[model samples]
Target: MWSAPTTTAALLTHVVRGAEEAGYNGLMVALTRNADASAQLNELSEEWTSVHDVTGQLIAVLSPDPEVRTAKIRYPIVYECAAMHDLRLVPPEDHDFGFNRCFVGSVHGDQLRGRAEAVPPRPPQEHRNAWTEAASRCASYFGITEAQIPAVLLLSFAERTAVLIRLRPRSADSLYDLCKQVAADLGWTKRAAELSARQRALRQRQHHLHRVVDRPELSRAKWRSRSADRLGSRMTDELRAQYDGLDRHLSSIAEVNPALVQQWRARLAELRSHGTVEETYRQLFAIRRHVIAPQDRQKWRRLAAKVGKVIAATDRVILGRYTQFWNLDDADPITAELRRQEAEMGRQGAEMDRTATEARQELRQIDDELNSVAAELGDIKPKHDSEPGLAAATEAAARHMLGQIDTDTVDGSAGLAGYTVRVVRPMAEAPVEHIDNSLSGTVFGPMVQAGHIAGGVHIHQHGLWARMRRWFS
Candidate 1:
């Protein structure tokens, strides 16, 4: 089972079989030898030539196994070449293969070939110093500290070379230009540009905020007159025309006294000065007390009150009618309504609590009576307890009967009458005298019989009462 190939032909056969088993279609042999060793080269060449044809034919054959049949078929040829020197030569202490030896393998058409070369040895100290110097230079150029040079050296040779190439200076105008290029490659340039733009925008916003804050008029105009002041200015001419028409109407009224007319004109002038209806109302109320003559003060007060009502109504129309300009107090209609509802709910909740307390008291009395009856009945042990086997058999029979009841209930295989017949037939044969004396045996026996009758009347009703009785017992 485990024999090494001893001859060239056996080795070649083994290699061919292995290649076939591994699903490989080709093989390459690269053995280092002296140029004078022609015999070994001829033997290997002959062995390959003999097996090459058969190997190709075997690889081309379609396998019956689905896994093998679906695989891509390859007609591979072997390349037997001898190296001119001993490429395997290395110090006896060095066992690492790829580190000391380099090999190049390639596949062409249906053929595979390879070449191996030994890496010449260098003094250990010199080798390490050269690598350290290269890593330090790369790390320094890339702005990495000297401490990170070891990590840089730990990378593969190709990766280390890539780092060196990246750090190498390109043709640029100056060091700053080179630094810009490096920053761009590292993506720092884009981030710095973004930060600079954000800083400029932030400064611009701060300047604008300072200018607004420094001027009180500007701040008030910006914040306070957002809507009404702007719209009011646009509608001022139209509103003035309407007021003028109203004044003309008042002038034409025959019943209006001249002094009252003059007073109303003064009010209109005050309205124009105030520039808002609410402010005009406030000023009118303040002036009303001192301005009117004592003889006409009562009538003028009534007229001023009516004018205030009209101004309030107009204000509601100009601003949104539904808008609540001030917070509601306890006297507000909505607040009054909410309080009334809360009081009604409190009264209803108290009534419900009283009713629930009465119900719980009644339930407690009923539970006490039931629990007393249960404790008295529980004191009487079953007579079959002295015979363990008989007691167990009785319990098993009860469980079986209950299981049958559950099955019948779930399957709906029998109506109430059928269930009653099945239950009563078994129970009628059992002795009612076995019931404890603590229970009224005569009453309980009849009640059990009545329950069977009720089961025939309605299975759901009987089941509900049965479960409740079981839980209480």
Candidate 2:
């Protein structure tokens, strides 16, 4: 309960007995209610100077000063005085244990006049009265009773003693700066009419605290600045670390998966007519092995096992160490570029693998074929010029033999207009030599206009065999 805000002083016994019953450390004063107790306070008064604003109030004895910490002192001590009475004691200076600073004094005032001597070191009763009135006015505007004020009041960081409120002594000002800034403009109304710049600054700080934390395009690095120290820096640090970690993962993936052949499968087709995607694919295509899934079923019976059906495809592929960096919300240039490069890298990496694999397989086949033909030719026996001869045949018989051995025919019906389709077949026993399509050229002379043939229409050349062992086996 609050004592009435009377200008008159509270009785000595009420202040001492009330504060002491609440376990105040004024041991000598609490033990004696006689004239001796007042004398003792008068004696110890030098060690702790009274803050004159409410110097005579029941609460004034409580000190929040570091040198004389009285934080354990609670107000409205329980008493058997069913005189139906109660009183609350408030300290002029609330003590600090761990909270951070609320403000700083003026640079010039801090340098020129120390906080203790900023005003008359020991303000006379008249000055105390004036300050008490100013504090009451300040409290009234804040919708708080003087008793409810949490920390010492201040004008501003730059102007410590410019106003009537001050809670720290100059000797201990540097030692005790950590006052929680719960209410900033407690006693700043001293120059409220003229200090436009200070008012703007205070308003700006208040507004800065209302920052958007979850916005997508927070590209500005303001959070890293010291100005943002009180504006949720700890949360920003954690979020930034997560983004960096995800970035590293994507960068690593990009490095290994660099762009290769754009559409390698399509390229291979425009090389192949081609295709596989992994180990089974390699076996099916590379080694030409049948890649069949297992089916455990009874032989020729209605007990055939059925393959399980896939009702729906999965919505997402598993990713490595995912975080907000993988989300589309971060539209910053750096993140977007990384995403593009990584996607391209994946495509190229896949194509390069397929193209390289096919090239290796085709080259192996070529090398084996070359070696086989060379070895077979090396094993051929030489023929003699004076070999035993059969009876000489007629030119007509020779021509007839040539007709069967080297045949050429044309089907004009199936050919294009003004052109005939020429077909040639060499006897199976004959060795491959240069093919002659001259008969068609002669038949169509100037009729067969411009033309181009990409390799052979059909490779009927023979004698070379057993290319790669892998192909057959």
Tell me, what's the RMSD of every candidate?
A: 50.4, 56.3
What does candidate 2's lDDT look like per residue over 378-452, in tens digits?
443222112211111111122232244333333222101122222222234657787655444235334322244
Q: Identify the candidate with maximal TM-score.
A: 1
Off by over 4 Å in 1: 1-278, 284-302, 322-473
TM-score of each predicted structure versus truth: 0.16, 0.13
- lDDT of all predictions: 0.31, 0.25
Tens digits of per-residue lDDT for model 1, 288-363: 4333344654544344333334333443444432222221223343234335545654677677556556655655
Clashes in predicted model 2 = 9
Error of 1 at 379 (Å): 79
C-alpha positional error of residue 266 in candidate 1 after TM-score superposition, expressed in Å:
4.5
Residue 92, candidate 1: C-alpha displacement in angstroms:
99
TM-score of 2: 0.13
Which residues of candidate 2, in runs, are more than 4 Å off?
1-239, 242-473
